[model samples]
Each structure stands twice: as C-alpha cells, then as structure tokens.
Target: MKIERVKSRVSLRRTIESGTEEQRRAVLEIISTVRARGDEALKSYTEKFDGVRLDSLRVTNEEIEAAYQNVSEEALRIIREAAENIRDYHERQKRESWIIAKEDGTMLGQKITPLDAVGLYVPGGTAAYPSSVLMNVIPAQVAGVKRIVITSPPNKNGTLPAGVLVAASELGVKEIYKVGGAQAIAALAYGTETIRPVDKIFGPGNIYVALAKREVFGQVAIDMIAGPSEIVVLADETANVNEIAADLLSQAEHDERASAILVTPSMKLALAVASEVKKQLETLPRKAIAVSALENYGAIYVTETLAEAVEVVNELAPEHLEVMTAEPMQLLGQIRHAGAIFLGRFSSEPVGDYFAGPNHVLPTNGTARFSSGLSVDEFVKKSSIIFYSEPALQRNAGKIAAFARLEGLEAHARAVEERFKK
Candidate 1:
C-alpha cells in the first residue's frame, strides 16, 4: 500500500454505487416469478440458486431442536449475552403513546405501533453469520413485534445453518424458512402458502437482495438498500498504525467491494499505516478479497490538518468511523455524518460488529450522509392522533373550511363545515 499525499481533501473519492443493469434485471425476474408462483417459485429458485430442492419451505420444530443440540454451549451462551446487550440497548429507544391536551379542549397525540410481523433475511453460503441473525431480529423483538420470521439459504444438503437456527430460536423466532436470494424477498413481499407476507423486511444480502429490496419497496417496507460495507478512520499521529490497519481490514474482509480508508494529517502516520496494511493483508485468510478492495477503494491521505481530515470524513460519510485523535470526544462534535462512530484506540470496529449493543447493519455507500443504521425504530410505525370537542370544532371549523376551499378541495371544506353544523 502506497500512501498518497494531498494538500486538500477534494481528491479522496471512490465509486460507491456499482450495481449493474444485469443484476437489476435478474432480481426483477426472480421477484416477478416468486410473485406469480408463490411457494413453488421459492423451491424452484432454491434449487436454482442454492442448488437444493426442499420438500418444504418452512423449517420444523425438530430441526430447531437439533440446531440447539448442534451448537456448543459456549457459543449459545455468547449469543444469549449479545442478545441481552442488544435488548437492553434497544429498550431505551422504545417509545410510549403520548397525548397532549390543550386548554381549548382539543387533544393531539401520536401512537407508536410495532409492525404486525417482520421478515428477517440472513445470508448463507461461505459461512454462517449468526451475528447477522441476532442483529436483524433482536430489534424487532424489542419493538414488540408479534411474529418474526427468518429466511436463510440452505446448504446443498438442504439444511439451514445450525448457527443461524440457534440464533433465531434464541430470540423466540421459531418461524424459520429454508429459502434465500431475491426469491425469498419476493415471497416475503407477496404471500406464499407457507410463508405469509410481512409488514416489513429487515436484513442485508448480496446485490440481488439489495435490488430485490429496491424492486419491492412499494409492496412492503425494507430496512434499507445497503451497498457494500465501508469504513473510514480519522486519526492523528497518536493513532497506532497496527490498530488502524487492523480496523481497515476488519471491513475490507467483508467483500471485494468493501472500502477502508485512512484520513490523517501526519504523512509519517499515513505511510506507516499503509505499510502495516500491506503486511497484515498477507496474513488474512480473505487476503484476495481485501486486496482487491484496497487496490480499488482503499487510500491513505495526508491532510493539511485534522480539521481537513474531519471534512473529508464528512464528505465521504463512511458507514463506520474511528476517531483516534488526542481528544476523540472533542472531535466527535465536529462529525456531522456517519452511521456509527468509535472513539479512542481501544474502540476497534469489530467490537461493535459482534459484542456491542449497537446494530452492525449500518447504511453503506455514503448513505450515512442521509440515513442511519437499523434500529428499534425501523420495526415500528407512527400514527398521528387528533380530537376536537364540539366547541373547539365550532371555533376552528370556519377557518379550516376557508383554507380547504382556497385549495379547491370542496369535499374537505364540506367535511369541516358539517362537523360544525352537526
């Protein structure tokens, strides 16, 4: 890795959205097929994509019990601990129904209601990421969602990953299914015989999953159309090169398109971190993926000062940012954009990925500039409440009718007038 020196922050840039037209077409076709054929479409696509044909799309209780036995006691304990942490953290975010009564005899309020049901999509293939399973489902549970269904691809043997099953079962989500890809998303959007349509879908996946979420936006709500994972580290000379390199690789190992960037004022620190990255990359099992990401998207920029480095981070708006300056908290106030921010040298990104209560499923591809990470709020809906006494209506009905008629909506004006007339 070669460190690049820049007098300004304008040059640090990378292409974030790289979804191809072919991917979109493929996802659309899968979604359409699933919409047309329901469960049969799911089984067909499972064999087509996952290379396995299942007798049933839903996982049975016997299978869940077997998954519990297959998992190690230690692993199960860790999952429970992480679940507790996530539950406790999200508990703070829960909202109650609030109402305000005015002296004029009018009442206004907001009702926060959880979705009737939610669908969680966990990826399968190379490895079983039980962590993703926990992250996606726990928040819905905290929000008081009644039915949480899980969908994950099965192996060639047509068995779902035991780890995924264990995680879902731990969270009281027993409605697990053996289906994946855009087809599962389609089934979730349009009800199948075995799998009912959910109020919203939550989770992350490959390009097909992201595109499917995009295609099915109007049919059902999706958490987000997440892109490749990304991380940006804003540090000073006090930052450790080894820690920085390790943090960058933590996200880089996610996939080839993932990004890991270092923005700092000291050229020496930048050069040292770049060298450390190259050295560390050689040892990682996912070396090929991380290397391609670094070659294409990774960079080390020597800014004029820490302030300029902060500006660069804001412009890029990375999914995860580690501020390792002299005063990390002081610099935090200046950070206007980021899905999650880690302070100090000890706060590496992986801690948040696995152990921390915060959801690791963050907005990617500079979307942090606008959106946020998945949270308990994502699993619920809000409805505005309003009430007016007869006297209050009499006082305001004429003004409301006048306003409605000015907009040329006669029905709205008449509705307001009738209230007073009654």
Candidate 2:
C-alpha cells in the first residue's frame, strides 16, 4: 500500500461496468432464446456452459435430503444460528398496513404487500456462496414472500454444492433449481416448464448474468448492478495498526478490483499500517488477488486533522467503513456515507459479513453515497391507499379539477368533475 497526504477530496469511484458489446449482444440472444424456447433453451445453455446434460432442471427432494447428509452437523448448527440472527433483525423491518381515518370520513394510508415470488441466483462451483444464500433468503422469508427460488449451476457431477443446498434447506426454501449463468437469470425472469416466473430477481453473478439482469429489468425487478467490494478504515494514532491492516485485507481478498483504504491524521499510524498490510498480504491464500487490488486501488491517506479524515471518508463513500479511533462511537454522526460501519477494534468487518445480523449484500463502489444495503424493504412493495367519502370529494372536486386543468389534462379534470355535474 502506498501512503499520500490528502490535498483535496478523495474519491474511490470506479466507472460502473456496462458489459462489452459482444457480451451484451450475447446476453440479448440468450434472453430472447429463453423467452421464445423456454425449457428447451435453458437445458441447451446448461449443457453448453455447465458441461452437463440434465433431464431435469429442478433439484428433487431426494437430492436435498442427501445434501443434509453431506453437510456436517457443526456447519448446520452455525448456519441455523446465523439464519435466526438474520431473521430476527429483518423481522423488525417489516411494516404493517397503516391507515389514518379523519373525522370527515376520508381515509388515507399505505398498504405493504410482499412480492409474490423472488429468485436468488447463487454462483456455482468454486464461486458458490452459502453465506449469500442466508443473507438473501432470510429477508424475503421475513417479508412473508410466499415463493422463493434458488438457482445455481450444476457441477460436472450434475449436483449443486452441498453447502449451497444445505443453506437453502435450512431456510425451508424448497424451490431449488439446478441451473445457472445468464440462462438461470433468464429462466427466473421469464419462467420455463419446470420453473415459474418471479416478480423480481436478486443475487450476484458474472458479467453475463449482470447483463442479463439489466436486459430483463423491465419485465421483472432486479437488485442493484453490484460492483466489486470496498472497505475504508478511518483511524487515528490511538488505533491498532495490525487490526487495521487485517480488516483492509479482508475486503481486498474479495476481488482484484476491490478497494481497501486507510485514512488517518497520524503519519506514524499511516506508515505502520502500510508495513503491516504488506506483512499480512504475504500469508493470505489469495495473495495474488489482494496484491493486485492494493497495488491498483489501495492507499493510506494522511489528513491534517481527524475531522478532515472524516471528510475524506465521506467523499470516498466506501462500501464498508471502519472507525478505529480513541472513541469510535463519537464519530458516528460525522459519517454520512457507508454501506456498513464497523466501530472499535472488536467490531471487525467479517462480523457483519457472517455472524452479525446485518445484511452483507451492500452497495458497492461509491454507491453507498446514494443507495443502501439489502433489507426487507427490497422484498416488499408499497401501494398508496386512498378513500374519499362523498362529502370529501364534493368539497375538493373543484380544486382537483382546477389543478388537473392547470397541467392541460382535460380528461383528468373532467374525470373529477364527472361526479359533481348536475
């Protein structure tokens, strides 16, 4: 990691990736084929990309039962506990349909309706993420979504990973399918013989999957087009150098493009953390990936004051921010943008990633400035409820007609006046 003095604003914003024209064209073809051919298209693409010919695309009950046997009891215990924590946290986010009744007999409120169905695409093979399964499914379940689907590519042996299956099973998610890639996304959006179309799609995937999501967005809602992971640690001289280095590397190891930064007012702390990061990088299993990330995107910024360090953090708007100063909580109000904030030495980033209740699927790159992490809100839709009594409409009819006519909407004005005409 390199060290520099902050002169002005610091920015970690990377250009949002729009897939190459070739990839975009390919994704379009896949989506069109799936919409036209349905089940046949899904199986053909599965055979071509996953290198397996499957007569059935859905995972049978027998396979899920066998997956339980493969997963160790200890892993199951941990997964169950994590699910409970996640469910408990998201349960608090649920909103009931609320209405306000006025003395004049006008009732106004909002109705909360859970999405009928949602599809989560878990990457297969080595990229499989059981943690993702927990993070995405629990929130939907908490929102009372009736149908939740899991889709993943089958391995050479034509079975999903045991951990992925186990995680889905633990959540009581029985709609697991043995398909992945852009085709899986297409199937989720458009539906096939074995799979039904969902109201929305959620999950992480490769470039092709992302493009497919973008293509199918109007047909079905999608989660954000996520970028690589990021973490920015705002620290001072009182912070521990070793802990800062370890926390930064935790995100760097995620992707070669992942950003890990340190902002502090202490020159000594900055230099020490830079050295510690190098020492720690030598032992990481994904050393090559982390090294590439640090070389390209990681840095240690020395600011003139702790307040200035906080300003730089706001400008960066990193996905994950760790405040490790004399009093971490004191800086909470100062932080305006961060997908997830880890305070003090004990609250490491991984705590939020796995064991902690918060959702780990966060806004990446610099999008934390405007967006938020995944939650129950994403699984439900809100509809405005309005009821106007005869007296209420009679009183407001003229004003409503005038307002609508102001916009040259004659039909709207007449629609409101139609009820009042003699």
Candidate 3:
C-alpha cells in the first residue's frame, strides 16, 4: 500500500463496468438461447463453461446424502452453529401482516408475503466456501420463501463441494441444480424443463454472471449488481498498525479489483500501516492479486483531522468500513455510508463476513450510499391493503370524485361517484 497526503475524495468506481461488450453480448446470446432451447441450452452451456457434461441439472437426494459423508463433523457443527446465529438474527427481521381498523369502520394494512421462489447463485470459483451458501440461503429461509433453489458450477466431476451441499442440506434447501455461470442465470430467469423459474435471484459471481443478471433483471428481479470487494480502515495513532494492515489486505486478497484503503489523521500511523501492509503481503497466498489491488486502488490517506477522515469515508461509501480509533463508538455517528461498520479493534471485517449475525453480502463500489445489504426485505413483497365501509365511502366519495376530477381523470371520478349515484 502507498500513503498520500489527503486532498480530496478518491474515486471508488471502475472507469467502466467490469464486463466488456463482448461479455455482455455473450451473456445476451446465452440468455436468448436458454429462453428458446431451455434445458438443451443449459446442458450445452454447462459443458462449454464448467467443462462438465451433466446428464441431469438437479442435484439428486443421493448426492445430498453422499455429501453429508464427505463433510467433516467439525465443519458440520460449525455450520449448524452459524446457521442458528443467522436464523436468530434474521427472525427479528421477519414481518407480520398488519391491519389498522379505524372508528369509521375503514381498515388499512399491509400484507407481507414472501416470494414464490428465489434462486441463489453460488460461485464455483478456485475454491468453494460454504459460508456464501449459508449467508445467501438463510435470509430467504427466514423470509419464509416457499421455495429456495441454488445453482452452482460443478467440479470436473459435475458435483458440488461437500461443504456447500452440507450447508444447503442443513437449511433444507434441497432444490439445487449442478449448473452455473451465465447459463445458470438464464435457466433461473427464463426457466428450463428441469429447473423452475424464480421470482428473484440472489448471490454474486464473476463478470459474465454479473452481466447475465443485469440482462435478466426485468424478466426476474435480482439482487444488486455487486462489484469487487473493498474495505476502508479509519485509524488513529492509538490503532494497532498490524491489525490495520491485515484488515486492509483481507479484502484486497478477495480479487484483483478488490480495494483496501487506510485513512487516518496521523501521518505516522498511516505510514506504519502502509509498511505493515507491505510486510504482510509477502506471506499472503494471493499476493499477486493483492499487490495489484494495492498498487492500483489501495492508498493510505493522511487527513488533517478525524472529522475530515469521516467525510472522506462518506464520499467513498465503501462496502466495509473499520473504525480503529481510540473510541470507535464515538465515530459511529459521523459515518453515513458504509455497507457494514466494524467498531473497535476486535471487530474485524471477516467477523461480519462469516460468523457474524449481520450479512456478509453487502453493497459494493460506493453503492452503500443508496443501497443496503441483503435482508428479509429483498425476499418479500409488500402489498397495500385497503378497505372502506359503505358509510365511510358514501361520506367521502364526493370529495374523492372532486379530487379525481381536478386531475382530469373523469373515469376515476365516475368510479368514485357510481357508488353514490343511487
């Protein structure tokens, strides 16, 4: 990491979207093929991208049962514990259908209902982490979604990782399909003969999958268009240099585009953290990727004051913000735009990523300025309920008609007036 004297808010966006025109075009073509050919296209694309020729897309019960044996007992125990924490946290977010009946005999309320079905896209990257599977699926389960389906790229043998399957089985999310990439997205959005269509899609993937989700958005609702992982550490002289360095590198190792920044008022602390980052980067397995990110996007900004540091944070609206000041809670009020805030030295970014009750999947690339992390709200729809007693409508109809007429909506006015015409 490099340290620079703070002047202005640095940008946190890529000059262009991660996907190239060719990728978008390819995703579009894949989507069209899946829409037209359905399961055939799914099989073809699965073979082309994942290098697996699957006789069936669905993960059978036999596979699920076999997956249990593959996962370790300790792993299963940890997953179970984490699932309980996740469930408990999200159960608080569950909403109930509510109504308010007035003395006038008019009732108004909202009906909170879960989506008919939801699709979660689990990445089959260089390594598979069951944490993502649990993070994405648990929220939908808490929302009471009738059906939760998963689509993940299979290994060369066309099977999901044992940990991923074990976590899904623990959550009772058995509707998993062993397909992935843009093709899997197309299958979810348009539906194949084997896989059922979902009302919304969740989870993140590489550029191609991101582009596919973008293309299929209107055909089916999708979670936000996520970008690379990022973290910003706001530190002071009291902060531990090693901890700050490790936290920044934590997000940087996520991918080549992942950003790790340190903004502090103390130049000495900033310099120390930068040096520490260099020392730590030497040992990280993903050093090349982390080095590229730190070289291009990472920085240690020496701000004039802590208040100015917070201002810079608000402007960047990073996905993960860590406050390592003397009293982290005192600075909480100053922050306005972070996907997840980690207070004090003990609250490392990964705590929220894995075991923490809060969501790991968060707004990225400055989207925390407007959007939010995945929650029960994403999996449910709210329908407004309206009712009016005959006496209430009769008394209010004339005024309603006049208000409608004011908008030159004569038909709307007539609809209100017809109840009173007799």
Candidate 4:
C-alpha cells in the first residue's frame, strides 16, 4: 500500500465495467435465442458453459434433502440465524398501502405492492455464496414477493452447491434452477418452457450475466450493475493499526480491482498501517490477488485533520465506510455518502457482510453518492393512489384545465372537463 498526503478531497471513482463489444453481441444473441427457443436454449447453454447436461432445469425436492445431508448441522444453524437476523431487519422496512382523505372527499396516497416474482443469480463454481442467497432473498420475502427463484450454475456432477441449497431451503425458497451465466439471465427475463420470466432479477454473477442484465433492463428490472468490492476506513490515531490493516485486506482479497483505503490525519498512523498491511498481506491465502489490489488501488491517505479525512471519505463515497475514530458515532451525521457504515472497532465490515442483518449487496465503485444498498424497497413497487369527488373536481377543474392547456394538451384538459360537461 502506498502512503500519500492529501491536499484536498480525492475521488476513488473507477470506470464502471461495460463488457466488450463481443460480449455485448453475445449477450444479445443469447437473450434473443432464449426468447425464441425457450428451455431448449437454456439447456444448450447450460451444457455448453456449465459442462453439465441436465434432464431438467429446476432443482427437485429430493435434491434439496440431499443438500441438507451434505451440509453440517452447525452450518445450517448459522445460516438459519443469519436468515432470522436479515428477515428481522427487513421486516422493519415493509410498508403497507395507505390513503389520506380530506373533508372534500379527495383521497390521495400510495399503494405498495410486492413484485410478483424475482430471480436471484448466485455465482457458482469453487466459491459458494450462501450469504448472497440470504441477503437477496430475505428482503424480497419481507416485501411479500410471492415467487422467489434461485439460479446458479451446476457443478461437474450437475448439482448446486450444498451451502447455497441449504440457505435457500432455510428461507423456504423451493424454485431452484441449475442454470447460470447470460443464458440464465435471459431465461429470467424471457420465460422458458420450465422457468417463468420474473418481474425483476437480483443477485450477482460474471461479466456475461451483467451484460445480459444490461441488455434486458427494459423487459425486467434489475439490481444495479455492481462493481468490485470497496472499503474506506476513516480512522484516527486512537484506532488500532492491526485491525485497520486486517479490515482493508478483507475487501482487497475480494478482487484485483477492489479498493481498500485508510484516511487519517496522523502521518505516523498512515505509515504504520501501510507497514501493517504489507505484513498482513503476506499471510493472506489470496495473497496474489490482494497484492495486485494493494499495488494498484490500495492507499493510506494522510490528512491535515480528522475533519479533512471525513471530507475525503465523502468524496470517495465508498461502498463500505468504517469509522474507527475515538468516538465513531459522533461523526455519523457528517457522513453523507457510503453504502454501509461500520462504527467503532468491533463493527468490522465483514460483520455487515455476513451476519449484521444489513444487506451486503451494496453500491460499489463510488455509486454510494447517488444510490443505496439492496433492501426491501428494491423488491416492491409503489403506485400513487388518487380519488377525487365531484365537489373536489369542481373546485379545481378550471385550474387543472388551465394547466393542461398551458402545455397545449387539449385531450388532457378535455379528459378532466369531460366529467363536468353540461
């Protein structure tokens, strides 16, 4: 990690990855094929990419039972507890349809409705993200989404990972599919013979999946085009250098592009943390990846004051912000950006990632400046509700017609005036 003295607010914005022209064309072709051939295209792509020929696309009940057997009891217990925590946190975000009525018999409000169906894309292969399953599913369930589907690429044996299956099973999500990549995304966007098209899609995947999501945006809603993981530590001299180093590496190990930064006022602390990070990087299992990340994106920034450090953090608007100052909570109001904020030494970034009850599917690549993390709100839609009585309409009809005519929309004015035509 390199150390630099900050002169002013700095940006950590990286170019959002838009897949290559070849990849985009491939994604478009895949989506078109899925729309035309349905399950046939899905099966073809699954066998070609996942290297597993499947008799069916959906996971069976028997397979779910077998997944339970393969998973340890201890792991199941932890998954269940994490699910509970996530569900509890999201339940608080659920909103009911409401209406406001006035004496004039005019009622206006919003009607909140959960999406009919949503598909979650879990990345498959050597790594199994049961955590992603929990994070995406629990919120949709809380929002009252009826059908939640899980789609992941199958292993060589044509079976989904045990942990991923177990987590979905714990959440009572039965519609599991052994399909992945751009083809799976296509199937989710356009209905296949076996798989129904979902109202929206959630979760993360490879470049093909991302491009497919981008291609099918108008057909169905999607979670953001997530970038690599990022963590910004706003610390002071009182913060633990070792803990800060450990936290930064946690995200750095995620990807070669992932960024881990430490913003502080003390040059001595910055130098110490840089050294600590180097020492810790040596022992990381993903040393090669972390080293690449630290060499390129990681940094220790020294500021003139703690206030200046906070200003830098706001400018970067990192996905995860850890405030490890003397009083972490005192600066909470000052932080206007950041997808998720961890307060104090104990509230490490991973705590929110795995078990702290907050959604880990957060805005990345400085999107926190305008976006937010995944939540119950993402799974539901709100329709504006309006009702006007004859009296209410009579009171405002002239003004409404005048405004409509102001826009030169005769039909719009007529539509409202038609109700009161003599």
- lDDT (CA) per prediction: 0.87, 0.92, 0.89, 0.92
Q: Write the per-residue lDDT of candidate 3 for residues 121-211, one digit (tens) a residue.
A: 9999787878988888888988888899999999999899999999999988869999889989999998989988999999888888888
Ranking, lDDT, top scorer first: 4, 2, 3, 1
Query: Candidate 3: what lDDT?
Result: 0.89
The sequence of per-residue lDDT tens digits that candidate 2 reaches over residues 291-345 is 9999999999999999999999999998899999999999999999999999999
Off by over 4 Å in 4: none
lDDT of 2 at 122: 92
- How many clashes show up per model? 0, 0, 0, 0
TM-score of each: 0.95, 0.98, 0.97, 0.98
TM-score of 1: 0.95
Kindly report which residue stretches of model 2 are placed more than 4 angstroms away from their true locations once superposed.
none
Collision pairs in model 1: none
Error of 2 at 319 (Å): 0.9
